[model samples]
Target: MSEVPAYLREGYITPDELFRKIPKPSEERLRARPVAVPECPQEIPCAPCREICPTNAISMPTPNDLPVVDYEKCIGCSLCVQICPGLAFFMVHYVGDKARITMPHELLPLPERGEEVVLLNRIGEPVGKGKVLTVVPREKTKGDTPIIIVEVPIELAWDVRAIKVVRE
Candidate 1:
């Protein structure tokens, strides 16, 4: 029998599994500008990410279909990031040697812009350190889910999905 998907087995999609299930943004796309990267691997009934996209970049043939992002049409706006009910959408933008990752932030004591944070991967494992670049307040988002942008090494961009704010 075919093996169970890693997302089902491990409760989170591993990088390898994610790349296998969805097309990774082309290198040319990554260097162009910020783009929405949906990590939703499950075929469950969900479509807010696609519905709320202002650029019509995210598309799903049906409610249960996995999201497909048209990188070229994406404007890199964080609307998808803020609207996704599962918090599966992210924005990746490379600037020189560093990359900015914009993701939904629901944790308490939100990190301020320029604050240092511990970057975490899909399974909540610490991957590296990064700095908060921007925090879109909840008042601006559709569901009141705040969004934050953290800058990390370009190499860690794809792996850094969440952050842990260390309070002094």
Candidate 2:
């Protein structure tokens, strides 16, 4: 394949993009609860994340533009994460000691709540272990992709995006 244009490269948004967009919530704000981090970097025309946001946290006037999010308004509900066809949204919650990170999970033999699993990084490299907090199916994902919430160390939470479960 030919070299991907810089603009097209943006389509492959990653956790790093989400990290950059994450607003620094004050200790007081953090106390209030969670917020969302959108990693959608594509210049393509897509706005499901914006339209599906119940709180109007994500907004996009034109399909060609990237969605804008109101950090304070975002509830970290992970609805955008599940509704995004590009699988570009991630909900992050920094709590007392661990971070509640939710990402889209489409694999079969889904992980169960309270189950232990091997955590993987952005590139799918095993990092550590985490406990499944919840497994949201398509029934509740706006008829789109399902989602999973995991509890891990705040440090690893930002890097870990995928998990491994022994199906055998």
Q: Which structure among the candidates has the greatest lDDT?
A: 1
Q: What are the per-residue Cα lDDT tens digits for candidate 1 across 65-96?
A: 99989889999877888888898888898889
Candidate 2 per-residue lDDT, tens place, 88-156, comes to: 777777777888888888777789999999998877879889999999887877747778999988878
Off by over 4 Å in 2: 1-31
To one decimal, what is the Cα RMSD in angstroms of model 1 from the true structure?
A: 1.2
Name the regions of candidate 1 deviating beyond 4 angstroms: none
lDDT score for residue 132 of model 2? 94
lDDT of 2 at 125: 78
Model 1: how far residue 117 lies from native, Å: 1.1
